[model samples]
Target chain A: MKDQNGFDELARQKLAERDFTFDPSHWTAMEGLLARPGRKRGAWWPWLAAGVLLVGGATIWITAREHDPAASVTNPGGGPRAIAGEVKGVNGSAAITEMENASYGNDHPGTMNADPAVPVTGETRATAGTMRGETSGEPRMRTEATRTRKEHGTGTSDRGTVTMQVNKIPVSSISVRQGEDPHAANVRTGEATNDVSSTMTGPGAAAVAGDGASDERSNLATGAVDPVRSDASAAPAGGGTHGEEQPDSVLQHQPPSAGTGPVVVAGSGDSASTGATAAPAPVDPVAAALVPPAWLAITAPYELTLLGGAFSTTGRYTGVDAESWPARTERQWTTDFGLEAVRNFGRHFAVGTGVHFSSYKERLITDEVSRTEQQLSTSYFWVAHDTMVTIVVGDTAINGATYHMTQLVPMTINELGVDTDTAYQTMVIRQRRSALNTVSYVELPLLLDAHTARGRWVFGLRGGPSVGLLTGRSGSLPDNSGEGYHTLNEVAFRELTVGWTARAYVRYRLSAGWSVGVEPTMRGQLFNSLRNADLDRRASAMGMMLSLSYRIQPTPQP
Target chain B: MINDHIIAGCVRQEPKAQYELYRALYPMMMAICTRYERDRQEAAATMNQGFLKILDNIGTRRKEVPVEPWARRIMINTVIDAHRRNKERKAMEGADIDDHAEGTSGINDYLKDMEAEAFAELLHRVPAMSRTVFNLYAIDGFSHAEIAGMLGLSEGTTKWHVSHARTVLRNAIAAEAMARTEKTVSR
Candidate 1:
């Protein structure tokens, strides 16, 4: 037997080669997929899409109701109040909701900036399996509150409403006119608060917290003057519209706890009423409009993959020809099949799992090799999810199909007058061997996706290790006595095996509905003993793949 | 089908920018499995299978990532996954099993001097099982706890599997220790 290299040293070397260059391949199938328009469906991806649709849809619905008269009159939180008929006076139920909405729009102060990095693991590779520590709290990503203004410029010549500015735009009432830049109106209204020092930040907070706080904060925020004009039918009604007035009154209110902080509400005008005849003032603090956002709401995407795999050991591997170590090699093919499913928790993040099965065989590429072949031997992989990190941990076959070694010299082609360089004459020495094995394990991969084009294209770099346990293998290296062949190691191979892999791929989304991708990968064995007593000696194989995919959103439309 | 957004992993080696990288390329990676794999399920499994190597060694295989000929390496492997299948066939043929005392330390310890990249290369030398353990405990941040939970192994057994990594790596390192040490700088 010949000597081999140190397994640990090899592993280190293998890992250090993270600098592999990239190569782009044409993925016909995937490219075609990206080019051909299609719809997207998914497992968990659907849920993510659905979640966005629900919230986004609700937001849109609110926006559509912005110009409705009934909505405006019914709203108790916005600043515009309607003049109802009957006994209603100059001051109907003061809109408390409007007062609160007004305070929320211009009073509170906050800022947006970059947050700190949250480290999830340690620096060294040895202690890779150590438990992770907790990270610090982070700030909210963003906070925005819009204020709408309707200017009656020189449109029909019959309108006198020169300009009306309504602060604090609800999700439902953004705008219908195309290509109009709204002005940012900031009002200095935090002066009335003397005893409102609790958590509320506004002039009117003092009126509610300490003394008799009426429902007037919403009016201050909305800035909607009373004598309301009807424009519900003239709204940017999708596709077809003619009416310039709404049947329902519009209502707007600042949702409690809008962003990531505490939300405070007082006993202000939470109730607002809009009717035909009533003592209407220049400004009502009770009623306002609601409007939802549009396509800008689509901030993230859902991802899915249909995958297939084939693994063959028709290459140099552990102890397959143990007798000569590296010099004598035996080719083995382990046909394995796998299926995996993945779901993204958010835009560049996800988790998944899979199932694996394989069949093993030992074949001598040269006369110097002859070993056992395992069939339909079972094994499976458990993983956190799918990633490009290329960690392939899970169960594996060991001596389950060990290729014991028997030294044998090659048959020289020169004996037959054939030149060594001639394809007609090939010389090779092989070894005879046999073994058995079965293994199962799990893989965890953390991926790094470098994003560009506002998340349209991405090149991914992922790496994480995997863990596994060797369950069992052929109890003994079985002899081919029935075939009159001697067994090299009549005993099973090692119970446990370990190694690592490094790989990468690049992907591009051609449009909103399609994407194409490709990746060339290489896997090298870092350790051994899973096959022969072979040490340090490793094997490697490289491959390329091309694929395509599409994007799909939920029904509600985010 | 190359979209404008994806950059091959080979071009990106910085440790600080990995999370975003994995996300952008995962979908197309899933589609890649259809070729060599029997079906989408197997392809997906193989993609996850590649994780053992990817998570553990992508930082080192930077060369392979870029030089890949139109083939993006999305952590999905083919040959290594084949090892178990080969073994399975032999098992059906009645190969023997040997339960012996696993040797410890000696050359295995000396080989430790080699860098992490070297070890990652050597991992590709053996069956899939060995690589899985070495990566799980040595590179991918999986704890024996999580590893055991995922692989359905006793924590103790999972630990033993990790220890077994030394033997597999030793055999590979012992063979090309010199060439590895010299070329280590290239990574």
Candidate 2:
């Protein structure tokens, strides 16, 4: 019984030893840990870091795209006005005044002063105006500016003088489009139903002008006379000029309006008008050619762009079957910035090219006994040129409003700094440089572009499976040991790499001609055998990029 | 069990609670971070992020929630996020887990003889990956399922890694403890 008491006491002491103590020093050590934002050279945290960045990046992208709608809703031409000039052309009286100035030589740079008594001669050929030689420098100037009207082209030339000069192109518009269907049935044409065609070119001395509008409000003043008013033909009180005989009249059999005809052409906004067929008519022909009721309305452009994000990659490096040594793999990532250029052709079929560069580095030690190893990478110059084709099947929306699909394809060229640091633990090893690889591939850029009052904003996940053909691959690698990887004969990459290329891009189009954007990318090489080896070792990478671009526009009614 | 210590430690930004909690948990937490981290900076970062949380919500700890898990979750996120960020750590279909494990010397038996503080210090010095595997498998009573879930891996991978980690750590700690014993005897 007494022995049991001693045993019980021992058990009690063991139980008491469990203090479950929390150490103050633990806090000190942890304080530093606590202060740290993450782990070091972490093999585990990169995934989570990628997740956070993805989420954050996506959020930022969304916010960036969303900001455009509120700013552009009220003003189509929200930017500064870039045009300046009176709306109307001078009439007969003004034409006479201009003729006087031209003859007198005291007139400003461009005042029409041609005599009104000139006989009419209709001709479809390039115009032929009699050159009036002047004694002062003005005569030489007039001669340089002078163009004569003669005759040619079918039998349409008669009483009107066909005047031809540089002018603004115009668009012929129908009605509002139903949706984003590019192949939607064509809207019915006006068919001279309302006599809405622009003025015609005349046979005699003809004058045609343009109503040019620009996106930027040009603050730079001009030293020359306004081209619109340079012609002596006086503008009507209605502020527009129309001609009786125009190119369109040849296609039609009806008589055109005198000086107040309306200008409306389908699909084209050509505003130039001529009156070479008026003969003895005193009516202001220029005024009759002017188009009526300007239509400056257009549906916003919708688009979606999926560029390469930090999660996307292109080039890869991995180890395959080497029985003597364990198979090893390593991937290099671009540490600096990147860029991508995309071009779209047709609706679902498009092709584009891009240039990319980054730092790549990785070292491998496969055999412990032989101690054979090498660092096969660099960080100076890298570029990628790639091409792709894609079909966008969906629409992008903002606040439930649908936007048009903007698909693009890019030819990507990757430029990288090639470098290597190698050391043999037990045996000597040799190394060589890899020739700059110019890989060509095809990819699809899918985008969700929203057309808002502020213009168009885009965000998308762009990616595609592609085939890469190596256009250039020539280099050398020397070995210290009898065994060394060669850039060409002994070893290097395969001739072709089948892989996944992807990117995420966000953009805001400020106007029909201008836009701004940023993109992040990820790329990797496919499981292509290296050095003629039958084994497949695939490599991958990820990064971010940015860019700015512009759109070429056809002269339009919008 | 001072009321102030208990209360301060439970409130976020409560200095006394933060101080006490920091003092109490620093070593253990550091051991945890180092065990699960790849490098000191990474471990420190996780730990730092964790500590900030502890400071911000020290007031809440007075409740019934477990402080260690709450802190560990943050560190786990940091580690996972960091790992994901590494371009090298891609998801390949097949990653051989057991083909090349080196046999370890037996050393886990000494847990009974050492103090918590001493053991914690020793654990701190062990390679973080090995330490984390050991702690999760041995002390924390985590199964390969739980480990794999936390580490974002397959169960087989978690099991193989834990076994390998245990072997290496056992050999390392045994040598260390033996050296300590020799030093004491010599003194």
> Using TM-score as the measure, which candidate wins?
2
DockQ in order: 0.08, 0.06
lDDT of 1 by residue, A1-558 (tens): 112344433444445444422212222232333234431221344356435544654443354344332243222222222111000001111111111122222222211111112111111111000001111121000111111211110111011111111122211111111011010111111111100111111111100101101122222121121211221111111110001121222111223212111112111122111111100112232222131122212233554433233333322333333333312223454433333334445433444443323222334322233354433433443334333333334455576864434444333232222222212323332343433322222322233222222233444422233223343322122222222232323434344444333334456667554566664333334455344353223333334445454455555545
Tens digits of lDDT, candidate 1, B1-187:
2221223321232121222333344453443333233334555555544533453354354443452322344342342344346545422321122213333345556455656445444454433454454455554445778767655668887677666555554545555654555789778
Query: Relative to the unseen true structure, what is the Cα RMSD of model 1?
Result: 32.5
lDDT of 2 by residue, A273-308 (tens): 112111111222232222111121122222222233
In candidate 2 chain A, where is summed lDDT lowest over 10 consecutive residues? A94-103
Error of 1 at A389 (Å): 99
Name the candidate that leads on lDDT: 2
Local error of candidate 1 at residue A469 (angstroms):
8.5
Q: Which residues of candidate 2, in runs, are more than 4 Å off?
A: A1-323, A326-361, A365-456, A471-489, A529-531, B1-187
